[model samples]
Target: MKLYQLKAKQAFPISKKEAWDFLSDPKNLKVITPDHMGFNILSGADRPMFQGQIIQYVVKPFPGYSTKWVTEITHVKEGEYFVDEQRFGPYTLWHHKHFIKEIEGGVEMEDIIDYKIPFGILGQIAQPIIVKKQLQQIFNYRETKLNELFGKLEGHKNYLELKSI
Candidate 1:
């Protein structure tokens, strides 16, 4: 079995609390996600994020193809970090970790996602051509959207990278 990892980091000119408040809220996902993705929350987003909370979403990852994704907030540490694991989704395995830290003039947010695609070797072959590119686009859109929402930190370059493990 092959596993893939995606790591992204961005510094925002905002306080740690401010970043935490926005990132911890599940409803704000759609606001940061690309509109073309058709990301919509189906349920489990009425209140604040908490451990064991399950959130369901319907996403159109590609043209005319939609899938139901269910993820559980398995861990949360107030303003520090949180983890979400996929219960049911397109991927065979999905575990995402989000972290926030206070920096010099603002806060830096980081994301680490470890996932395994379905279909064994065929999925491995498609990883670079399709999955990697799609995920890169999604995170790119998110970075742009976040920059618009909260101004970017000066002299700090955001980064996103995906690699096999």
Candidate 2:
């Protein structure tokens, strides 16, 4: 089996506590996600982000089709990191780890995703082309969204003040 992994990192000019609060809440997903992909939470998990917490979502990456993805939180460390595994989703297996740290300037967040596409021969054939391409698209969107959100908060004093708490 071919193992595929994607790693992404970004630093925000925000405190670790603020970043933690925003990312810990599952409902903030759509606000930070790219609009073109049409990602929305289908069902907010019953429990907060913790080991074995399941989060269901409906995502439309392609036209005319909505994929239902159910991911479970497998590991979590408060104000630091969390891991979400896909129990039933499009991919054969998906394991994603989100890491956060308080750096000198601000908070740094890292996303490490290990996933395998369905079907043996098909996965090998499509990895270099299709799967990799889609991963890039999704991550690029995420980066842009983060910049915009943080940029707005930084430029507006009142907004930043309100979120200061």
Residue 107, candidate 1: Cα error in Å is: 0.2
lDDT tens readout by residue for model 2, 1-165: 777778777778889888888887788778776677688887855446777788999888677878999988889899999998998878998988888898766777888788888889887788767777777777776777877776423332211100000
* Stretches of candidate 1 exceeding 4 Å from the true structure: none
lDDT of each: 0.97, 0.76
lDDT by residue for model 1 over 31-117, one digit each (tens)? 998988889999999999999999999999999999999999999999999999999999999999999999999999999999999
lDDT for model 1, please.
0.97
Instruction: Report the Cα lDDT for residue 137, model 2.
Output: 73
Winning candidate number (TM-score) = 1
TM-score for candidate 1, residues paired by index = 0.99
lDDT of 2 at 52: 73
